[model samples]
Target chain A: MEWIRFFITAALLIMGMISFISAVIGVYRFGFVMNRMHAAGIGDTLGLLCVVSAMAVASGLNMDTLKLLFLIFFMWFTSPVSTHFLSQVEYYTNRERARFMTFRKGGEPRES
Target chain B: MNIDQAYHLLFMGALIIFAVLIGIMLIRAVIGPRITDRILSINMIGTMTICSIAILSGLLHEGYLTDVALIYAMLSFVAVLILAVMYIPAKSTRGQKQSRPEMADTAKEKKLQQSQSGETTRQKARKKGKKA
Candidate 1:
């Protein structure tokens, strides 16, 4: 039983770390900030989810597990909001942003 | 072989991998071409750090570290939010237009696809035949 649990935990944790690795590689490879954000955000959400859930499983249904779940929920909420704000900053600040993306000539700010 | 021993080994491996990833992200932050790139890398690094802390809480059998992870999440979020919001009003106030070039490409693709419907294809074929 213990070995089964360890294997499960190991699989999840390693996968999560792999996601983070890919994300970092993406950050280095992508040419544009928005494209990089797209990569980083997925890694953030998925990697955190994988690792934390593995921790929770190892913890075996207790108060600590509950807290871990809360941490995930909090991260899920914050990640997107932060990304939104970051992209808004990107949109408004990148003077040549037009070179990377295409949009209407003029319109109300579309929700990112 | 034993459960505790196996878990300990796994946890140590995870911690080491995360540290390397975080280091790479740090380098990305350092050499990032734009402010957004730097911040994006920072956000990713913070996220990976939080995961490391969570794993440490499990490995060290410390309840407090769990709480610490929770707090770190909030702090990281606030940091990114502040950095992002700081740039908004100052930049957007200039009435400058920033287009989504990818969107424009997609729109152009859609137009091209629309113009290439079956009837349009047949019409082009007919025109070609007539020319021949």
Candidate 2:
């Protein structure tokens, strides 16, 4: 039973690491700022969810686990709300210029 | 160290990585060209910080970290909302009006006006073509 618990915890930690790495890659690789926000949402909510859940399990059922659970709940509620507001601001601000790669609008590349 | 000790070390290492990510985000916040970009980075950093706090609480077996994480989350939400409200007309009205003096003497504005007029003409022609 102890070995089983250890294996479960290890698996959860590994999963969390993978999620975190992918989020970092997404931030670096995505074309535009708004798109990067999209990537960030993925990382913050989903990636962090897996990582925190794994950490919670590893810690077992203690007050620490309760705290971890609360953190997870807070993230789940806030990440999307924050991301939405940020994207809305980005769109309205006209700061959508792609610094890394140029993306076309509607099917035609913008000639600027 | 034993395997049990190794797990604690690994957890600490993860927290360190999370902190580095937040630092990179801070650089982005500082250098962002637009107000929205700054706000976005700031919000992201806040979220990452909360996560780090949770991880630390777990690692250290301290319950205080949880309360810190909760406060951080609430503050970040409020901060982002305030910034969003400020961002709207602050850029459009103040930014544009302030830049108009520089824009008046610039070729860029002239070219923009010409292109806009050209677009209007194109729209009229397309309407005419459709009617015919």
Question: Number of the top candidate by TM-score?
Answer: 1
| lDDT agreement of model 1 with the native | 0.81
Superposed model 2: Cα runs more than 4 Å off: A95-112, B89-132
Every candidate's lDDT: 0.81, 0.67
The candidate that achieves the highest lDDT relative to the unseen native structure: 1
Tens digit per residue, CA lDDT, model 1, A44-96: 79999999999998888778999999999999999999999998888767666
User: How many pairs collide in each candidate, listed in order?
Assistant: 7, 0
Error of 1 at B118 (Å): 28
Q: Model 1, which residues run further than 4 Å from truth?
A: A105-112, B90-132
lDDT, residue A27, model 1: 77
Candidate 1 docking DockQ: 0.41
For candidate 1, what is the DockQ-based docking class?
acceptable
Tens digit of per-residue lDDT, candidate 2, span A1-112? 6556666766776676666666666766765677778777777787667777876776788786787778788778877877777765554445323333333322113111
